[model samples]
Target: MLAGIGLLAAVTVGLTGCAGSGGSAPAASGGISEAKAKTATSAADFGGMKGLVASANAEGHLNVITLPPTWANYAKIIAGFKKKYPKIAITSANPNGSSADEVAAAKSLKGQSTAPDVFDIGTAVLNQNLGLFAPYKVSNWADIPADFKDPAGKWYYDYTGLMSIGYDSSKVSTPPTSFADLLGPSYKGKVAIKGDPTQANEAASAVYLAALQSGGSADNIQPGIDFFSKLKKAGNFLSVLPTQATVNSGQTPVVLQWSYNNLAFGAAGGSAGNPNWKTVILPGSALGSYYNQAINVDAPHPAAARLWQEYIYTPEVQNLYLAAGAYPATLAAMQKNKTVNEATLKTVGEPPANFVQLTADQATKAGTLLSAKWRAAIAG
Candidate 1:
């Protein structure tokens, strides 16, 4: 039987400001001190997180470790979770600089006292560390398509985002329609891409997209390397991927990034206040990947973690992620809800007209091979 631990409440203070407004100082009644009133205001400024406080009280406590330097607007998700489960205390930690850092964290949690209850990992990492996870088939498991989850329930994808090219409309009159176009003379030095596929999702995505373009399966990434080789030869490859702020600031005209990143950037207002930054889906590309969530095998608060899982999979939470430009993992959830804005929806291309979905086994095999071949091809 799962033993319930003593409830301990701790708040993970986010960068976002506190939730409520403060009232004016009360008039002193019978010589009450002004300092007390000032203290009251300060308390109001940083006093209570009712949601987090309540969650900690009711569901024990939760510790969620994730890839750090946080994503844009992730605070909203954390705040939303607290609102729904105020009794579940959440503590977030980031040890290593990149997603690779999570590996060390997972190892530390093994049969030890300091393991995280929840983990947000990349697909590649998920493939490598399935043993670290505790399999709890989520209540909404049936709703998720077979392609997006682990059959034994070790880990499940919460959301999927495609990697694509974002082009500045002002500089490039015609967007490149396919991978071949990226190698053309006109596009030389016009593309900025994040390098180091071994350590970066964006770089891995570039390899995946290239494989599709070159008739390579996700399991076979040689095509991706060959594709990049040509781009490198053309001198069109930019050293680093552009950030949302950089893209919005118009520092780079063309960038390879996740679709959600492009959507979020455009919604926040693009270059020159035009909101015209656009992402195009490359035809025949195996470029989509998922950001997955898993429960640690030694979760300190399993019940609370499960509750968090249920909450995130709900239509409400799924839609919230969608509104923020993430693609919901459940097709039924997406169809039943209408939270993604029209302008944002318009920019998201339909899955390539004749695309094929990769099975878990296939994706793992392909990702591994592709990583190896990409290194060789790029070095050539």
Candidate 2:
């Protein structure tokens, strides 16, 4: 769910299985042996990036699902990939689908030419479906932190954002400074999360954040559920999913989402977007989470799938994420090597010093609890 940012409109996009082999049977392309390219862990396996690109071009198609154009500057990234490798045809599907939808698509489309070549997903969902991923390290694998990726490269962190409150300034005359403030009558019937917490990472994280603010620790998310139940009871929570159109129209006046998403909304807003949109980080509430990228083990276009992975990890694409207010997974490496855009970094600013990124176990535990309790807790 990573909310795919603001899906503006549906665009289609949509992982799996081993350190070297799962069930992918890539055909020989550009003279590369079928087995060699199919099992390539790194570009060096194909001799280098040049060889990988050639093989991918020969295969000539990438089926990505659930990647919304408005999310994390993906439109430009997709366009850039096309410009860089024109021979590779890209098919993007189900742009606004949730993380669960991504998994479902991969299952239903298994063994087909149109199955998702890659996935951009939440950690919670990815962990639950690990068998679906293929382990393949990118060229810059060493640069990624051990904590952000699986040891076998089944999946790796892509970009991330901290939880924050976004509000239409015109509608919220007195800005809320904390989760507690959101319950005030001034904000009644105005607050919303990104999607169903039981099915979406962003919404789930919002609940986690509420848990932290309402006396629960990372190990216990019950307070978050209790808090939402209270919000609903107070008539301060809106059930509708907020979008660009909703924000601009003043239908969804307040939202709980990632900093990057809200910041993007406000930046593109003020006139053509929201007339007075603003994003705020509530005091002592910096819950951060990163979306992950994984190649489907049963990918129809194996070579192209790996190629796309290599492309996104490049400095150009990483900076594109930063420009859109997201913190790329390679940010630490980029900073050390002085490759990051200084201006963009300054514009994006630093995340709260106390930002809390849940461990894999923590996310799993939370998702399980939500799956069981979220519906009943939020039901009217």
What lDDT does each candidate get? 0.57, 0.81
Across 93-149, the per-residue lDDT of candidate 2 in tens digits comes to: 777678888899999988878788899999899989999999899999987899889
| Candidate 1: worst-modelled 10 consecutive residues by lDDT | 1-10
Residue 233, candidate 2: alpha-carbon lDDT: 88
lDDT of 1 at 102: 66
Q: Pick the candidate with the highest TM-score.
A: 2
Model 1: CA > 4 A from native:
1-61, 65-75, 87-98, 108-116, 249-251, 269-276, 284-286, 333-353
Q: lDDT for model 2, on a 0 to 1 scale?
A: 0.81
Q: Model 1 over residues 124-176: C-alpha lDDT tens digits?
A: 76777777776666566777778677787777787666666778787778887
